[model samples]
Structure formats: structure tokens, C-alpha cells
Target: MKEIAQSENIEQFSLKNYIYIDKTEYIYNLIKKYDRVFFSRPRRFGKSLTINTIGTLFEKGVEPYFKGTWIYDKWTQNTCPVLHLSFLKFSVSDLDNFKRDFCNEILKFAKTNNITDFTDDKEPKVLIGNIFSAMPEDMHIVLLIDEYDCQLTANINNKELYEKFRLFIREFYAVLKGEKHIRFMALTGVTRLKDVSIFSVGSDIKDLSYDHAYSQMIGFTREEIKKFYIDYLKLGISYEKHIKTDCVTDNDIEEFLDRMAEHYDSYCFDEIYENKVFSTYSVNCFLQSISQNQRVIFGDYWYEAGGIPSILKNYMESHEIEIDKFQTSEISINYDDFMNPTSLPYMNENVLMCQTGYLTLKSEIKPPRRIKLGSANREVKAALNSLLSQKFFNPDALDSFYDADSILEKGSVEEIIEHLNKVLATIPYDKYPVENESILRALLLMYLSGLRCDVRSEQHNFKGSSDLLVNFKTRRVIIELKFSKDGKDTDTLLKAAQEQIRRREYGIEKLGDRELLQIAAVFDGSPNMRKITEFKQIG
Candidate 1:
């Protein structure tokens, strides 16, 4: 940012560069109400920077860093021996080395602060409180910890490590929980993780994750979006029309805001409220994209890219339940079900993903709540789709990639459909029974979707949508598959299929002979797809 590069601190006005926007005001406001604060946000959502700014304001040093920010005017320059410790580095593999490693780090930190009270064989928690105790009588102590879940979350599968690390951390945090030499305290992480457990001393500090009051404290709000658009017009984004109508313009706006919304947005704390959350990662990426002319979004590098999906794929493939219809109820309606760090590991990924801005909570039944992967942000969706369909996937593969022209021009539709049918026929009815036709359609979509083309089930039509439709440029085909399960008679199934097709307007477009079309019938009258029925297009 020009503000960062230029020495003219007085001229620096807006925070269009880093994650230093709303969290500053948030910390300042919280400092007024609560002496001790524990805030949970997904990683990289400006927690560290916020804490850093707090140190600059209240700590002993105030040089170039505290120049033009709003805190300068309001800050009384309180002389406090401030201690900044990051929880992310507490990561250890095993229990024995873990304790020694953490203790050594704390010792080194104490030496840096001119504190000599710590000695071997002493509880680390007691030493942590001494950080404040050693401060001069003239100065108070401000403690800031970022990524508070690191010690407990990292290498969570190792029970021995977790128990030891948990106890150590519980003791370390207990010093603060007990309010020992603690003033203007703040702790940051992705989730309010301690509802089931505790760290030692204090009564529960306020958790604002689901609180409606400070919802906009961490990310850019819709109003803030308009302000940014207005200020940065050279980006060529128009928010005027949206302002008149009390809406944000989706068209012609640089995909930056949209991308920001997708990666971090759609985090609705309350089930009834429809507010979207902007992730700290995607917003920063957008700013960098604008600065360097590189378009990026949540999918490009927000968090773990191909890894999580592949992990989920492997688990679903190995399991008996059909992956397509897999729901949270299958996992006892627990969002943290994905938190397992083994086959499909959840600890690092879950906490880190949420903190780094990839996944968010969709809803909560009671304790943990339901976590979903993708954002409901339209801009973020567009940004990701552009990257995933074209950026991530290779363009050279024809039957391999989405450029369907190569497939329609060079290959036979009949052969393709027949090959797909052969594969479909192989799926044993006993292995994956048709719980419902919709579920069957979803399974078919999953299999067909893997083939590069934009394969969609329940394709939108005049009356409704088709069961499946694949549009490859000029070559378009609509196919309707039917399955009769259990006690349902063939006539009833056939009628339902016909009505669905008619309602969905499957053949309304009228494809020529150059295009191959099939109205395939998959009869699951018995346990196998032995009885077959076929329908072909005359055109």
C-alpha cells in the first residue's frame, strides 16, 4: 500500500491495504466494556494485526507503526509491559518433547523481557502470570494470544500429547482466567472451543461469534462495500445504481468484492439472520489482486485446495453410505464430526480452515452446530467457478475437459452414452439401493459431473427443470432416467417419470440428428437392473 511505502504518515487516511479496518474499533470498544476478552474468529481474519495495533497503542513503544491510525488520538499512551505470544507455535508432535519445547520457548521469552523469576520444575502457568508480575509498578500488563487452539488442535489424534498439552495450556490460560496481573487482555481463535472444557482461572470471557451486536466487527459490511467502491472508482466498479435501489450491483463490478464475499462471506451466526461474512483471506487476496492485476478467490489459495475434497472423497468411497446423499444426520448432526484427524482428519483442517476463511458454520442445533464447505456468496461463487472450471482443471483434455466441442465434433454420442450406461449398470442395486428417485438422480449427477462437462441434473426448463442435461456448445441433449423401487408398481413409476419429463420440458428444444438424444429407462424392478427399457429420439 502507498501508506506503508510512503513516509508521509499524516497523509495516510484509509485502510485499503491490510486487515486493519474494523477490528481496531472492535478492540477499542471491547476495551471499554470488558477488561478481559476472548474472541474467536477463523484464522487470518485480522486477529493478529488487531492485537498488534493494541500493543502499539497501550504498550511502551510508539514510533513509526502508530503514526496515522485513529488509535493515536484516543490512546493515552498507557505504559504497560505488553507481552505478545502467538499460540500457533505451540504445535508439538508428542507429549514429552512438547512440554520441554514449550517450557524452553517461554523461558527464552522471559529472558527477552528481563524477567528471571522462572526456573525448572515449575508449572508453566505460574511463569506465564509472572510475565505481568515482573513488569514495573508504573506500567500495567497487556497479554495478547493469537490462534489459541494451536496446542490442543495440532496433532490432536495423539491422546498422550493432547492430554499433556491440554493440561499445560489449561494451566497457562488459567493464570489469565484467574486475572493474575492481567489488564486489557484479549485472546483470538477461530471458534469458541471451550464450551465443553476450560483453561484454568477466569469466569467465561464474552464470546461474540454468534452475538449479533459485533457481527460486522471483523469483516466488511454491505455499507463498507459501497464506500470502498465509491473511493476506488478506478477499479471501475459501480455502486451508484445499487445505492439508489438500496442494493449492491453485481454486474460490471470488479470481482474483488464478490470474491471476498464468497471466501469469507455467508457466515450467518443466527439461523434467522441472512447476513454474509467476509473472510480475512479472500478480502486481502482481492486487495492484492487489484494491486498486482492478478485475479484470485477462495478456491485458488484460501486454504487447503484439493486436499480436503480428496480426503472427503476417499472416506465416502470407502463407506457404505452413498456419498451423494450423505447428510449431517448421518454423523449425529455434529459439525465437528469432520474434526477427526485420522482417515479424514478434522483438527488442523477444521479449526485452521475456519480461521483461515474456507469453511463456516451454516446452522447450529445446540452444542457445536452444522458446518458447510462452500460460501453462499454469488460473487465468491463466480470467482471460484471461474478458477475451478478453467484455472484448476486443464483445458487440453477434451473428453477430459469441459470444452465439449472436441467431444461432439470428433466422438460419437451413442458410444459415450452406451459407455456411461455400461458403467451405470455395473453399480449393484444391493450396494446402493434407490432410497428415492431424487437421490438416484443425485448419484448420477456425481458420477457424470466428474467427466469435465458442465453436467447438471434437474436442468431448468419452461415448466420446471429436467432430470439431467449436458450442454456442449451447439450440441445439447436431455435425458430422463427412471427407477422403480420396492412396492411401487411400474405403471405408477412410468406415470411419475412421464409427468416429471412433461413438467420439466425435457424435449422442448428439439435437437437434430447431428445431436444424439436418449430417453433412457433404468428399471430397478428387482434387486438388479436386469429388466431394461429404452427410448430413442426420432429427430
Candidate 2:
């Protein structure tokens, strides 16, 4: 076996030696045409790495350092100053100080270029404008901004400050977007904020984020992985450990490669990537592992270094929804938009889902054009499901969600809820975990609603959702759950819920399936005053 263990040659392993695919070539092309360029990416996904690579190409003092780089051989154009700023280190405690933070980073970038004259300026944007103007006219100064979305992302719900800070950013970036003095500008971030103004006001900017041609630019393709791993495979590091067992052969590389691809692939550009993407971050992390002679990094690459499941969970819990609902629904308005009026911006859940990697675009036709996008491929879906299920949601409350047998099982399903109701009937529902327990119960009911039933949230039931419906089951149930912050009374809440359910004809659609649909009301913690009622769905 050809051994390329990490201890054997740790010093020689550099991305420069590894063939950089995708976005790299296109970025160089853009550099040739424009002076200032901006790009964005999520955290730990190689945003800094891309900038460092660009640094090797154009940093004023690092010119001779590009000796073996592909860019060194092909980039014969005149040199320009590269202004790179990574704002990951910047703290955004409040939006009010975002401009100050941004301006300070701009100062740091300027200082790196030895421009320290106006570091103390109060009007930092003006100073920034001046710095752009000060760039030598003969050479284009490349402006690379990483994590441009950090400030805004750090405070998603602070509408007033976010909008104010966004405007500050708009005015600052406008200097580069203007006709004179600026070369090409590239800005990058995790996702887009509709009111960020960068997308709307930037005149000539083109988003290559979703461009298929540049798709492989930022990541390792299935083909790249096979080639890169050929050496590792020969090293006795058993390809079977990662791709297959020793029984595999060269002829099996195709099937083995396909398996490797599925576990790690996900598309993110309007879901343009689908399962085609190889989680660049994950692949790199794997390569790091393989080079270190660690064959099994983790079960699947998607669960490890690729995407942060916790971040997704934070979004889900904050929104009070499940991961499955996100996979199935479209998000037109962010929860921030719901919390703050000015933050209202239409978000096509599909597009946002695609951009963020949960969904991928499936099809597009030119003549009779229509775009079809859907959840990531089966492999990614499985990985995501596994990752999300393990998240902390009252860890001690429920060890697991309903399984296959628990679901779609007639007597079993009813018994599961009935068991839950009996348990709930005895407990105090006005406490901390009470809402979660009740919500957990609701989630089980919602899961059952599936193809046969439909559900929505409203405020008629009490302080929480008015009615939740499940139409497919033999008897549809109109469920409502509410709790009081201070008092323990749930009698009124239960009555309101039952009345609302009846008035809205919650089980009207289930009439054909059964003569009666269960109608129950709980005052949550209304002493022993809780009420349970049943009614017929028929006329």
C-alpha cells in the first residue's frame, strides 16, 4: 500500500498542491476584468481559505510567494493591491455599533496595505470612500469582504438596528459600486437579507452563487475525490473503510464512487446543487482525516464538518417548527419579519431553502420555462434527519420521536396519543416543560395528519394556536393547546378551543371517514377543571 499518512508528510500538504476546482478559475477571470471584488460564504466553509488563496495571487508583499500555484502560471496580468478583510473576529453585540465594527475592519485592511493616515476618523464611511479613491488609478485594487453578513446575521431580530446598520453598509459599499475609482467588488455571506440593499442597489454585480458553471468551483466533485484518494487507496488505508470493502475492484470504483458521493453531496444554489455537491468543507475535513490515516472520520461526511445542524436547530426551535416542516414548507417571511414590520420581505421558501442547502433545484426548461426544486437527495435527507433528531429538546423529556411502527399503525397510534393524554391529564401544564410536552403531543398528532390531514396555527384556542387538524385518520381531531404564564386556569382556554373547533368545522372533511371526530378541550392547568368532549363530524 502506498502510504501517505499525515505523520509521513504533514508539511507538504497544502491546498495549493491539491487541484482547486470551481469558483477559483472564475474568480481570477473576474479579477482580470474588474478591480474591486467581493464574495461571501458561511462560517468555516472556506471563506478565509479562498481569501488566503487570493492573497497568494495579489497581496502586495506576497507576489513571489505564488511560485507553484496554478494562478502563478496563468495570472500574467499586471499586479494590483488586494484588500482582504475577514470580519469573523468582529463582535456585533448590538446593531447600533455595527458601523463602528465595520469601519474598524476597513481600517485594519487599510493598515495592512500601509494606509494608516486616517485611522482615527469619525466618519468612517467617508474615510473608506477616500481609501478607495486613493488606490493607484493604474492598477485595480481587489476588495474582498468575507462574512459580509455577520453583523446582520448576529442580530436577526433587531429590526430597527439591522435596518439602520444595513443602510450604513449600503452607503459604504456604494462607493465601490459607483462608476469611478473601484475595480471589481465581491461580497459574500451565509444567506441573503432582502432589505440588505446590496442586492437591490448594486448596479453591475452578478451573483454567480447559483451559476451551474461555477458550481464545482468551490467544492470537490465526485471525480475529484476519486482521483485525490487514489494515492490513499494504494496506501493500504482500505478504500473499503470509506467507499467500500477490500472485495471492491477498479471496476467497482463507479459504484463505490456513487456511494461516496451520495453520503456527502448536497446542492445549495436555489438547490441548484441537489445531492450533486460533495460538501467542500466535509471533503476537505475528510481529506485531512485520510491524510492523517484516519479511515472512518464519521459515519457520513454530511453529519460532521459540512453543515452545522445546531444552527438549523436554533432556527427551528426559535421558530417553533420541526425540521420536516421546513423541508416541506416554503418560507416567504422570516420570523424576524413576523416580529418586526420593516423586516417584512418576501422570501420564496424554496429559493431560501435552496440557497441554504436544505433543498436543491431539480429542473429548468428554457422555452416553456419553469423551475422545479425539491428537498436534497435521499442521502442528505437521511443525514439531516439523523442529525436533527439528536438535537436537545428537553433531552430528559422524550428519548425519541414516534417510529415507523408507532406511525401509520391504527390502534397503536391512538394508544400512543391516548397514553399521552392520560399522562397529561395528571400533570401540571403551566410549568416550563409543560408547553414542550403539550407541543410534543401536538407534533405527534401533526405527524399523523400527513397526506390524510392538514394543519394550521391560529389564536382562537387560548394564548396559543386555535386549532390543529388531522383529517386522514378514521376520526379527525381538532386539537388546540394553550397555557397561562402566571395563572394555572385552563378551563376557559379549553372551552374556547372546543368552541372554535366546532365553529370552524374542524372535522368537516373527516365526515366521510367516520361518523364522529374527537373534540377534546383541556384548560391546560385549570386545576381539576379540565374538560374533555367528543362530537360528530356529520351534519
Candidate 3:
């Protein structure tokens, strides 16, 4: 064993330097049952490391790395002729180049086994069979492929080009089927390319993506945190002394853990067991921040390093969905709906969000079959909030929204509308088409929620629902929104809006003694143009 340092950087991610979380034993045991396996997980969730671990365990002359781990003692000398490849290492400009590079990679593996009968003129898809033929009859080949769908994800927006790449890759992967010479084959990637028709051939290939047994494979469980991170806990003292300039205590350490979990944990994949797991990338990033700054710093490091996927941004805007609604709505998608891919501009936003790691599975329903989803954690929420604020709300609108806190504090509905109209006026003309009153409502709802205000849209009350319900510590605001076509009287629309709120008695049941501010707003325009007709303090 190497001399252990009093404080080691958890961000040092090599297996030799990294603290082994013991998932390798579980993974090795579970994976041995299947000859061909496919596992998909979000990026930076430790897919590469897991692939590396598996390769190390199976390949010859790599026993030194596993010296301290469970796989070291429990297993016999079980080595195989391993052929490892990662798509990250290859970038091709055209189909011919891709084919050439692919064949060369496979041929390189064959040469290592001291078999060199394959020619450069051979097709890449059939190259695997040639490699299989060249190997000794007694030996079986172990094939490990990492980031199998990297090219497709990298060019997701270019559907025309991506389709070509997908077709070629799918055909190549299809070659793995019925290959008796293969001892084990595993492919790992961030996404499952369901449309590609790659894994359709084999019932033997296990998709451990959502399996409960492997949920803890790619990331940290709470138990793993306590077991592996005990030494780094004391780094809080160094943080307090050097950075925070405050006293550090055991309570602070506990608080740090809680905050860490809140920001980066709570990603659930399995339907039967909704196990919360931390994103290994974010955890390492957090630990690295603490080590470098000698203090705890909360950030969207994952988002910072890897921004929101462009596909997600395009989906929200094209659907004309309110950014706030996209953030908060109770989205449910059937299993088929979640897995199947439609064309761009028509893709299911909920599925895209869930698969991309922004949203985590919340619950599963059977018989009609649906999955409920919400933001994975505070990090995701923060990233979305920042994206929404940037894409939709301008500084003037944001200022007006913040001013609403004080406007509501004074129980003045008219003043609140004045602030809101300021926000409305500042909205960029190209923000959204604002085709109808619904879009207008969505704007306000999204903005208010983004500000971290307790705002609900279409919240049901005793008699009916309020368009917007703003909650405060000791008060509540009930708002009714109305829209009119051009030439409609602004005063009449405002009166009708007020009448609806009064008729519903939105706050009668719950606003005892606490301030109840009733508001009404009216707007007029076609989808192309809109202006506020009236805003008033109804009560």
C-alpha cells in the first residue's frame, strides 16, 4: 500500500489515486452473468471510470491497480484478450474517413494479438469478424466500447449528418450479434439511441441504465460518502481558518454534507426503487473547489463546465411554452414516449429533460404507464433559473419583479400592477410571439417563480381558481387576468377582471386578518403585438 496523505484531493480521479467506492465488486459480479451489456448514464457520472475499471479487471498484466480492491482477492486469474476502444479518441470529417479510422482501430487490436491477416480495403462493419478469425481458436475476445453514441450527441442538431453517422454505427454494432468468439462485450454512453436499431438483435444484452442493482454504480450514495470522505471532512478547519475566517465545528461539517447533498445529489434512475445518487462529476468538482479555496463554495460547476444542451433550449422556445411552466409544471410521459425519438422541433420536452439529467424520475404509474418528473436538484434548478432569466427576463423586468416584494408589502394592488407593467414594457419584442393571453400569463408566472417568490399559477381557491396567487409570510395576493381583442374598452375589461376575483372570493377563506390584495389586469393585442389596457387595485 502507498503512504496515505493526511489530506488527498478527492478530485484526483485516477483509479490509483481515486478512492474506490467498492461498486467495482458489485458491478463485476452483476456483469459476469451477461455476455453482452449496454449501460447508459449522463455524462460525468463516472461512465469512463467504470469502463476503465471493467477493462482493468479483465485485461492481462493490470493486477497492480486492483491490489487493494475486493476484485483483487475474490477472483481467480481471469484474463482475456481485451480489445478496448473509446469514440472520444476519434473525430472524422467524412464517412470514408470514419470507416478508415474505425478499421484501423480494430486492426490495431488484432496486431497486438500477433495476428495480421486483415487488409485496409476491408469494411469496418465486417472488420470485427476478421479480427475474431485471426485470434487463437482457444481464446475469446473481450470488446469494450466507450461513448458509443458520442458522434450522434455531438451533432444532434444536424439531423441530416447525424442520421448518416447513426446508420453506420448501428450497422457496425449489429455485427456483435451471434458472435460466439466474444467472451464479453460492453458499450457505455450518455444516451440510449433507440432509433438507431443497434441493440435490437440480442436478448442477452442487459440495459443496466435504469436497473436498481446498478443505480449506485455510476455515482455516490449517502453511505458511500460517509465511508470514503471522512478525511476530507476536516478540511473544513482549513476552510474556516484560511477562507471563511470563522470558527469551524462538527456542526459545520454536517451542514457542509447536507448542502453538498442538496446541490448535487437526488438523481433517481430506477422505477421500482427511486434511489438518490450524487453526480460523480459534480461531487468531484465540489471537493476540488473546497480543496483549492480551502472553503465550501456552492456553484453550478457541472452547468458551468457543460452548459444546457442546445436541443433543450430550442425545444422550450419552439413550443411557445412558458419558461416558468417548463420549470414547474407536473410533466408525465409514457415509457414509449420517453424512449422513442421524433424529429427536432417535435421532440417530447419532458423526455428530453429527464434523459439529459436536468429532471429526475419522481414516480411511476402502471397500466396506462406514466412517469412523473421534476428538477433533479438545486444545481439543476439554479441552472434553469439562470437560463430563463437570461433568455426571457431583462434587467428592467427583473428590477420590477424584485420591486413587487415591496409593492405587495404595502397591500397596494394598483402599485403592484404599475411595477408589473414596467416589467411587461421591458420585455423584448422577440422574447415570444405572445400569440394569446396565455403566453402573457406564462411570462408573469415564470418571472415571479424565477425570482424565488412563492407564486402559483392557476391556483385553485374555494370557489374557483386565481390566475396568479402570490404567497407571503403574513399576506397573500390574488390576481385575475383578462385579455381583450382590439377596440374593447379597457375600463370594462378591468371591471370584469375585478368582478371575477370578487365573485370567486379568492382570499375569503384564508386571508383572515392578514392583508389581502386583489388585483386585475387587462391586455389587448393579436399574437403579433400586445399592450396593457388596464391594471387596477380592485380591493
Best-first order by lDDT: 3, 1, 2
lDDT of 1 by residue, 1-539 (tens): 23111111212223344223434456567677777666666544556666666666666444544454555556554566566777666545655555555667667766766776544444556656565566565545677777666655453455565567656666666566656456777777654444224421345566555555566666556556545433332242323233432233445344545545544467554323455556545554555454454322224334332223322233233333433422111212344443322211233333333333333445442446554443334333333233222312234433443423354334564645454444445445555554665656654454444333445566665677667776664566666767666534666655566666656557566455445353544455455443334333323
Candidate 3 deviant stretches above 4 angstroms:
1-16, 60-62, 199-203, 237-254, 310-325, 340-346, 365-367, 385-539
Local error of candidate 3 at residue 433 (angstroms): 4.3
TM-score of 2: 0.62
- Mind giving the per-residue lDDT tens digits that candidate 2 earns over 397-501? 433233322332343434434544543343334431333324544333333322122333332332334345443345444544454433344566556656666
Model 3, global lDDT? 0.68
TM-score of each candidate? Answer: 0.67, 0.62, 0.74
- Candidate 2 regions off by >4 Å? 1-24, 33-44, 60-69, 112-119, 133-139, 233-248, 266-275, 287-346, 365-370, 377-379, 382-394, 399-539
Pick by lDDT: which candidate is best? Answer: 3
Candidate 3 structure quality by residue, lDDT tens digits, 369-412: 77677877767765666556556767644555566666766646
Model 2, CA-based lDDT: 0.48
Better of 1 and 2 by TM-score: 1
